[model samples]
Target chain A: MRVLAFLDGTLADPDAAHIRVDDLGLLRGDGVFETILVADKNPRELRPHLDRLARSAAMLELPAPDLEGFERAARKVIDSWIGGRELALKLVYTRGIDGDPAGVPTAFAMGLEIDEKVQRARTEGVAAVLLERGFGPDVAERAPWLLLGAKTVSYAVNMAALREAGRRGAQDVIFTAADGSVLEGPTSTVVVAKGRTLYTPPSTIGILPGTTQYALFRGAEKAGWTIKVEPIPAAELTTADAVILASSVRLVTRVHTLDGVALPDSAALHRELVAAYESEY
Target chain B: MRVLAFLDGTLADPDAAHIRVDDLGLLRGDGVFETILVADKNPRELRPHLDRLARSAAMLELPAPDLEGFERAARKVIDSWIGGRELALKLVYTRGIDGDPAGVPTAFAMGLEIDEKVQRARTEGVAAVLLERGFGPDVAERAPWLLLGAKTVSYAVNMAALREAGRRGAQDVIFTAADGSVLEGPTSTVVVAKGRTLYTPPSTIGILPGTTQYALFRGAEKAGWTIKVEPIPAAELTTADAVILASSVRLVTRVHTLDGVALPDSAALHRELVAAYESEY
Candidate 1:
């Protein structure tokens, strides 16, 4: 399989590749991680994404990855591209090899071929559901053993929610804490257009801070729109004029339904965010 | 750099090992693990330890390890022993490699050597202190995002706590929640003897269920000692005759202090549990 490898800002092959049974990330969902999308040979929103990765690593006390090195390697991978096809590049750093000093972490990066369908889905809109079987917000907040905000490698439950949504015939899932507060989609940031204002959850409330969503908001302001960061109740989600899931590759895709309820037209908001993200480049 | 290697229950030379970093365990902390003492070339309390491993895997919906094969491989490693001395063995299994499947997991296994110094420290007793850092317990019961009860590989935090304890000049650290409920140590189980009954925190409280402690409790009961599984407060620990940290290799070691406060002798309980572990097989 094709993969991008790097360390300290140089592109290379992974020195060692294969998961040991002892790795904490996969075994206990015991880690956090961040994924940045590389568009048409350029990593979108590099600074904000790396900044979030550092913040998450610090929260978990995991040693910070070599961000500068990572950026160089990522660029190398993008530069190696001979075509202008939009690519999905992911940088994953796990608490490294077992039996080593716990401080230094194992890191790797690779490019994936994301389906072109996601870009089309953004305008056409995708179906979604509110995941009901989710952990409580306080548990997500206070459990030291819980890797809440940090995107450590432990992501079983998160992936499970996606599968459950798929089995029910939805393209993605939005989660609400036990207390009924709307969180985010499995791998995307949640955004809703209320009038002309763009709203997203604050990361401090245990959501992965989305670099793409932040950029969209910045572009939104320039496009003459207001932005709001607030705790949204799950009940309020279905009433949004347009609901969207934002990630690097997907940009912003509108949610056409919540559970089984058909959402009202959100094509205009979707178009606005797409144009905003693209124009910023 | 001595290490042990086990695969599908067969002992292999460490250099002959093979694993893929993409294995679910390494990628997602998507597996369970156990550490057991190799006493007189036998895995102490084998049945219960294997049972616990199966239970933990079940909790994560991963396939159980091949216990019968595991037994053969473990014995093979024991037979290859160049020295006839006792040692500690760690067994780790992960879901094997995959192309980032959403939910399905793969599995693999490996063995490693535990420090001989840990065994030596048991005879002299170790100084331990309680960290004011709270490890909230209620969340384990309520939070679906938590794998608190399982001894999964996502143990970076546990190791971090131990490193932090060492930095503070303490041999070990115990965690207490904000409300003052005592939790387990970073690598071992915490047990305090009060009057006649022996007490240890329940695994349902988000700490690992200790194999050594479980075996020792059975040994204690067989020897007519009263045992209890409940929450112990920090205040109660300071008042105890002895506080012991139990694990496979250490067996049962006495705690001499709690956050710098000296404690009375714990030789009796330590001796009792050590004999109990030794008498097995």
Candidate 2:
């Protein structure tokens, strides 16, 4: 793994990426980040990820990140990494040290190999547990301060949900709203298929709009598959012809079982979706 | 300002306190923390803060922190600071670097002069706004992954709420549940007075039980005031004889106005509560 960060005006060793202890990002999780997939020294979906990062920063009211600088830093890191292997490129922007209300933001980029666990889950379908996200679908519309649509780094609950799934002998989790409407995976977007139509929960319900999922949907739509974005009740998931979780690094991963109940297999559909995702990226 | 960290077994300068950028605490906000007020070189309410930190760690399923090690680090930092002035002593413990599941936790202690804003809020009271917290009181009991009662450092929402308040020209916020029940302040516990009764929202509502509020309640009880724990609607706040937000760092701040509605003065009660808080510490 090689880490490079945009410090001052150029890339530096990430080991030197020490932020002040009082940086609001570390102290209050007041920041946003994006992870891009690098294949063959190219960052996949760079524009979308950067746009989302900007939206996230805007939602948190942090200063807008210097995207051109970030791009240079990202390219530097990707160029330094070993070739012919998939790499995870991460960009982070924090609100900087505390007590300085309008302080300059801390920005960094790093490159590392994709985790083996994500690879395994992508190849062999994962058993996912259903967990309550503790929010209703309407909460986001009513409470913007919750930062539900933004990809802020305050992910304690998401991490805890994953840990809870691990304790229950599951490989992943799909968070459902208090009303039992399927929300999203801890770090991925939930996608379901019925006949020729592919369905995903609407991002309006506070789930992050997954960049990979969006690209996959674009490809799916071009392939004559109907794409629907709407509320997906938990009960509806079990009846779908196929189910999967999608993310930038993992691509598209089939969901074999949900809440201990074996889901219908659609290996052909999984292959088609994975091909679509790869082709689009 | 002086910062020291307990790395392995020794205390080192906080500038040397950098953890891996991939540390889960920095990456996913997987951590717990406490801020203690050190007045005249004595750390106030150390035991309660430690207990809360342990409880918070337990909630996140992080390994139990070494309390004795933390105490020693706190003492060392306090000793290094000049006396006679108040300092904010912050203790933080984070799940270590990413990909190292069993990695040792990162623990640190920092001492800085209390922020002028906090000092002013404590003495001059503050105007607060009521905002929806987006969850019902029962959310935590039904969904533990939310980690509501735990004071983990994933405070993006809290910081956002404060920022929203600031945008509205208010100094603080009192979060209300989806059901219109008052929850707590972003950083303080909401306390209300009606005649001789001092009421605070119940901890079962998933609010972080305020340590300072508990101490104040104990002292108030000793001084012949009735203490009650119950749900308070936003409308009820206007009718209370006195309203205040209390926390360890900001001892007791009267609520001058809520949502632009001026609250009645409670100088005698505020004085008595402040005296009680100081005496208890």
Candidate 3:
């Protein structure tokens, strides 16, 4: 229950501090953010992590943060934590404090709490359900009024999708457009092993460009695995050799089942991806 | 620049109050909100506005506010404000603060400042540009996320799209998916007059189900004008007899051009939509 927020460069107690109602992060979910894993006293993929944060900010048109200062702050936060155990560190930058009430927000940043259950699930893979693409089909057919490739803070639907999956006794949800194209997990990128070739939907399909997945793909390639970034339909999920969700802290966790069907072993791919990320980070 | 926040059944200064960071509105954009025109000391479409607010909240699974109570609070806020004249009123209700950091936010509301230029544009109209579909065209089309029909607070991209349009020297932006399906405007519903019929992209295409647009469509129907909700294209925008951005405050402002291509008799459609909204709301 102890949660802290990294407000710009300063850490504040989220429970006691008050955020203004006009903060764009609260008003319009108008901003970009990143969630990096804090493992063994170090933030994994420091440079690429900052790079992705900048990209998300640019895609959303928010002002960029001082990356050098931010990195130092992040490390400071990690170093100051009394518990040296593994933790999920989230850095969210909103469009700022005030502007045209209806206009794009200016910029703000703060850390958020990560669910302990998610950490447990990372170590022990869980089941997921295929939710009917709530956003509808053609969502990824082209660039949206805003690109979906950015990790903007406006993620209400993303969390809702996962909640729906939980109601169905699944740990997570994988979105499928109305046309049956598999997009990505609610909070993670997906990878499916098809024979010797690993396939994932390209970022062009409106999925957040997954940094962890990219690292995993690079690792898979170095291990002599054929990798393809193409649209995969929901129906083909069960037929793959294995299915795994890739993210910063989780590294990669095998999906035991999608819906009611059991999944094949994905330990090998998960192991490879984790090793790749750990080695590089 | 004074703004009031409507929380539960009370009003507070948005700048003076403190909000929790764990509010679902901030963490996930998991809420719905509305901004109405407070003209001549009265709130426009007050009843329908609440209905839309309730519907949007339902879509996000947030608890609904006390409708009658909310109205009382709204009236109180308006009464205390500079009466008459023109002012913008925003009603935002996030799930009351909750989740792991706290729990799942139940619901909350707040008000915001209105742009003077928006009201002026009603008579002057404004220039518009046809940009690629508003954010998440692919996700909306293929993955089927929330059908941009809900007025959920996750509108970071919508605001960004408008800014992008402004950057292009247009007052507003019309989103067209890469596949060439014309969507809605950034903050307004797009209505095109083609011959004797009116056509607008369907809300099913992930466009925010605009309250003002709904009223206008209803008014147009009563005025012996046929209305169609169908997929429009960028090419059709150039050919349309007129195009208007429809919203609560603006009612309808004709778009003089799309990407620099001129359209004719803009004010005629503007008046039509305005009349429709006023009569219906």
Interface RMSD score of each model: 5.4, 1.9, 3.6
Candidate ranking under lDDT, highest first, comes to 2, 3, 1
> Highest DockQ among the candidates is held by which one?
2
TM-score of 2: 0.97
Question: Which one wins on lDDT?
Answer: 2
Please give, for residues B87-133, the per-residue lDDT of candidate 2 as tens digits.
88899898877777578887888887787898888878999999998
TM-score of each: 0.82, 0.97, 0.86
> What is the per-candidate TM-score for chain B?
0.88, 0.96, 0.86
Best by TM-score: 2
Q: Write the per-residue lDDT of candidate 1 for residues A52-169, one digit (tens) a residue.
A: 7777777666677788877776777677655447676766676655556644566656665667577667667788888743445555455444445666666555655666677789
Q: First chain TM-score in every candidate?
A: 0.90, 0.96, 0.87
Clashes of each: 34, 0, 55
- Model 1 DockQ (Cα-based): 0.27
* Candidate 2 CAPRI grade: medium
What stretches of model 2 exceed 4 Å from their correct place?
A7-11, A15-17, B7-17
* CA error at residue B14 for candidate 2, angstroms: 4.3
By TM-score: ranked, best first: 2, 3, 1
As for DockQ, the candidate ahead, 1 or 2, is 2
